[model samples]
Target chain A: MDADVEAARPWVAEASPTFITLIDQNHLLSSLYNMVNVPQAVWIDEQGRVVRPTETGGSIDILREFDPEAGAFKPEAMARAGAAKALYMEAVEDWARNGADSRFAYDPDAARQRVSRQTPETMLAHAKFQLGRHLASLGRVVEAEALFTECRELHPDSWNIFRETTEKMDTGIAAGEAFWGKVMGLGEKQYYASIDMDGMP
Target chain B: MTIVLTETSNSECVAAPSTTDLWLDADAVTAATGWTLKPEGFCKDDICVPTPADAENYVADGKVNVASFWRLMDRPAAASKDGDVWFLGEGATERNDALLSLEAPDFTLPDFSGKLHSLTDFRRQRVLLITWASW
Candidate 1:
């Protein structure tokens, strides 16, 4: 979900997927599902319910390999970027064919268990984010910036908020210096939350 | 009391007066959220919950204390420094229920052509929703 629709449309057209591709300028999906990062995913059954909450969707921060100064990845350092993606892609195909019977799909209890529980802080963070975004839409940049900064502080795990807020404010380079700052700041913490499918290493 | 303008994901609410206690007049409550105050409590459609037993704490003069109402509805609320912008967030219990039902929370979004699409429109078929951004 990006505010800049025209900028991203060309790339999406180039891919030319058969499925429907929609733009979420309001970040509705992320807010509804409590998603904190892009390249994350959720599976839904025919009934229109979420079977998977949020998975890292094979993004392993290859962006980190890009030196902000050089603006490119170090040679050979990007090898494993989509390493697990092939496996996940295969699983989706199986799911399409087998429906809920696919081993990749989670059952009701398990699926419910997997959905992230919203906390007081998370809810409040979202509130701050909404208010900030509204102000930004109204061109109240200074006010929006303050609320967005508060949103990031309240929900540090929400890289979506952090990245989007930083990008909107034209603060630091969100994809470059800002990205590395987030990654490096996570000292000893796991950047990606582990997925539970078999044959995933 | 100062009137604070507010808007939600879809609708603009009646300009509710600012109250440190979150006491919104009856009209503001309906406009801010679809739920309407009833004898039982605040309700929308078939779902209803009892308002707090202490009537004086909730109903005073003509305003209803929405903060107390929100607690019963299980919503979390926030507003800007001036309270001009208010957001009442979805509660945990309701989100949990949607998960248990295994029904995907449907949304309407626009395509490159600006045509709207709803997830429910694709129902009767499985969907693999992969979220990505140009960032």
Candidate 2:
């Protein structure tokens, strides 16, 4: 749900995806579905019940494998990431073919429960981010920045908040220095939270 | 205490303290301000503005007088003449409510060509909705 639809167009067009590639300039997707980072996928059944909450898609790890020389990730971590991606893809295919019968599909109640464990702080971050998005939409850039900063302060681990906030301000904070520095401060091990796909069919 | 928080824009939905006191409940404070109390402070993310030492005086019966708290921070908030309703700036209670339900809130946004599409359009289909940015 990026604001820079123009920038994302070339990549989406190049991929030639058959699926829906919609824009969310206001980032309602993030605000609504707890999508704190890109490529976080959720599963829903034909009945429109959410069967899975937002999860790391792991596509980024495929790219990480090629850039091992970047020195941020170890070869072991890359392999773990690759295995995770393969497992995720397999689960997606299973769900696609098996529908609600898929072993990967959780019951609606289970999925809802999983998604409901948000801390009050996280909820506040989500609220602040939505307000920031609203202000940004209205061209209240300065006010939006204050809210965005508050969001960032509230949820430092949320890449969606940081990226969207910086991009809106044209702060160039994501231009490799400030962002990377923050990441480095957080440590490479803390980059992406590991997902447990062990029970997925 | 039973301080009512009224948004300057929409004064009708005055945030009333569920508990009696001049202090607003943490929940009420959260509703009034898009802020939840955390160990670090009244936090939103990685950043936290520390709570002042005397903040407890402003809180009573598990509620906080956020207007008083805002004053401690020197932030701006409007108070009504009767001093019962305090007006805070914009908040995201509605959005947070939508999110807590885990139901994908319907939204419409244009593609590169400006053709608008709603999330409801993909109902009954397995959607791989991904968020990507050019930046």
In order, what lDDT does every prediction score?
0.71, 0.60
Model 1, A100-160: lDDT tens digits are 8898888878987877765667666776677677767878889889988888888899887
TM-score of chain B of each: 0.77, 0.47
- Name the lDDT value of residue B83 in candidate 2: 44
Q: Report the Cα lDDT for candidate 2.
A: 0.60
Best by TM-score: 1
lDDT of 1 by residue, B99-128 (tens): 566677778888888798888888888888
lDDT of 1 at B107: 83
Off by over 4 Å in 1: A61-77, A167-173, B1-9, B16-28, B53-57, B60-62, B71-74
Write model 2 residue lDDT over B28-109, tens digit each, in one string: 5666566677666775546466777886766556666666655555443444323444434323444445545657666676
Give the Å error, residue A97, model 2. 0.4
Chain B structural similarity as TM-score, candidate 2: 0.47
- Give the residue spans of candidate 2 off by over 4 A: A59-76, A116-140, A167-175, A187-189, A199-201, B1-104
After TM-score superposition, the amount by which residue B43's alpha carbon in candidate 2 deviates from its true location, in angstroms, is: 30
Kindly list the per-residue Cα lDDT of model 2 for residues A1-201, writing each as its tens digit: 666566677778999777667777655566567677776877765555667777777554332333436756667666666777788889889888988788788766666656634444555666455555555654767766887788788777778778767643364225355565666576464455555467322
